[model samples]
Target: MGEKPGQYLLWNELRGDWCNYDIVGEQYHGVAIYGLLPDDWSREGFETQRMFELVPEPANPHDRWAISVRADGKTVGYIPRQDCQSWANVVRRVAASGLIAMVPGRIYARDAKNWDEWDGENDPPREFASTVQIKLGDPDGALPINNPPTVPYTMIPRSAIVQVTKEDEHTDALLKFVPGSGYGTLFVTLHESVSGRAASAKPVVEVRINDERIGQLTPQMSQRFLPMIRHLASRGLVTACWGDIKGSAVAAEVRIDGIKANEADEVVLDGEPVTLPALIDKQDDPETYALPGWIDMAVQTGARHSYESQPESTTSSTPAAPPLPPAAWYDDPQNHRMFRYWDGLRWTEHVAPKVR
Candidate 1:
């Protein structure tokens, strides 16, 4: 019989290992062994050895293999053919099964033990173990949030004059002066005389100096009026007051920068009225404000027809022509009405009046 199918051992040339054969009376099956070999026995070495032992034992061992060739005249160990195949199958099955079993309880125990041993007698703070927390609340309920109230402030010019009067028991009339680019004046009037009494019935005019408390004023015989006002004026302070006098007012011209006033029937500065005209001119001509050099030129040229000539259709009752074209219409400086003849270059002397 040829070498028994299952009873023989062979060297796996591809994997460089020895294996066993399975013989079912006639059929053959392969079995592999897990082991190492001397480096000199592999193809990468000398390639002189063709086979190696499958098992270390001889008679009736679990698996056995033959040494077919010796490369360096040295001998190694043996392996059981059946055991080789079984070992290979077990390795393959274990590799294919993806389940990896771990012991969580054991791992935790080990970690705890290691930690206790690594850090002794001291521990981290308890607060450090907890995370921080934040809470948001509504803003409108006495808390700072969106949409807070705002107060606005505006600056008044130093030149502006202000007037104050007692309008009623609760309110006072305030007259204010506004200045234009330079110095201005304001005037005020009193409706009733201040009572020269010490009783609370007298009106009180309290003046503040640059937001600092200075002094108080009530029309009284004991108080010095002009000296007090003069002192306040010299110090560049703004005055405001409250009291019982009606139609009582004050006015003055204060110097300030970058303000100009126009002539109007009534001028109100910072809510106070000014009666004086801010600008003045002596000329009576309505057109004087609209045209330049009009008055002087009118005297030189005399009144001329308003148009080029009377329309051919007009009778003796026709209106005169419109005035001559402006002096700018002449191309040359010498071509004034005194020098140039009309040659159709411009309107005829009959059409346009000559300058004297």
Candidate 2:
């Protein structure tokens, strides 16, 4: 808020993630991990639908979001400070992670006509970086739209290679699909159970291969992952159930196929939104909105930071999360034909069509 200070603590509650912040001059200052663009980024000229990414610089200790800008098949520059917040919010609301992680947005170009001025980490980046100038809405791209029928959507595997290890503990527990010793594709699905008490419980997504349910991803991991998988399924790109095993003790105790990085879209596949991801709760299970930090100024009152509903519940040992809600197929807000399970307190990764 002052002096474009070096990256400072700036917490966002919507995506349920925090990062450092620093302002730029005009104001554009500093930079983030650089991505190189095609030489023609300065050649073919910037156009409509040029994409951008909100990359968090966690190592900076200043939580700076370098609005990664891309054009003509290359990641160009970044969004200048004045425009970042507004666009970031627009992308956050609709996305599950709520961090502007990677929804499609664009920027346009008006005054600049250059071919080599971008500050990528590549050699001679400073020469290009110094010549670069970005203004608000320049090379603007369309905001995210619903899965429009006319506009085709398809899945491009987030990772070219996904290596799943079969030596997992659950792989042994479920004996049906695990590789005998070597690694193989352990096809898992996002599962929901209607087998138990109907009204008294709602089941979460279990990671199952063959017929046996060996284990499940953590609640938070499942929640973050479900939307992306659904979006891909809608496009017919992803065929596996949306499943990830992280964000809780289940991540530590259970052995599922391992992903190399954190919060990766392992293709059942693909997605953070900004403002700690707004937790969705109905009238009955509103999570306690508690804050643990302090405000720097007198005018800024109330809690300084917030957290999402506990990632894990008390009775987490069993198949269901604690205090399971009445088990019934509830409406899936993301899709009309399918319904999500409102397990009382939270939405489970499970979804089925009302007709199904």
| CA lDDT, every model vs. true structure | 0.20, 0.29
The best candidate by lDDT is: 2
The TM-scores, one per candidate, come to: 0.14, 0.22
Clash count per candidate: 38, 42
lDDT of 1 by residue, 10-91 (tens): 1011111111232111000000110122323332222111222111111123322221111011111122243333232211
lDDT tens digits by residue: candidate 2, 1-356: 11111111111111101112222321021111112223345432443331233332212222232343322212234455565544443322222222223323333222332337555554532111212332232111222111112222221212212222322556445443322222222234433432237675534345554445566555444453455545555555422321222222222222332222222333213321111122212122111222112101111011111122212221111111112222333335455454454443576685543321
Residue 305 error, candidate 2, Å: 41
Lowest summed-lDDT stretch of 10 residues in model 2? 295-304
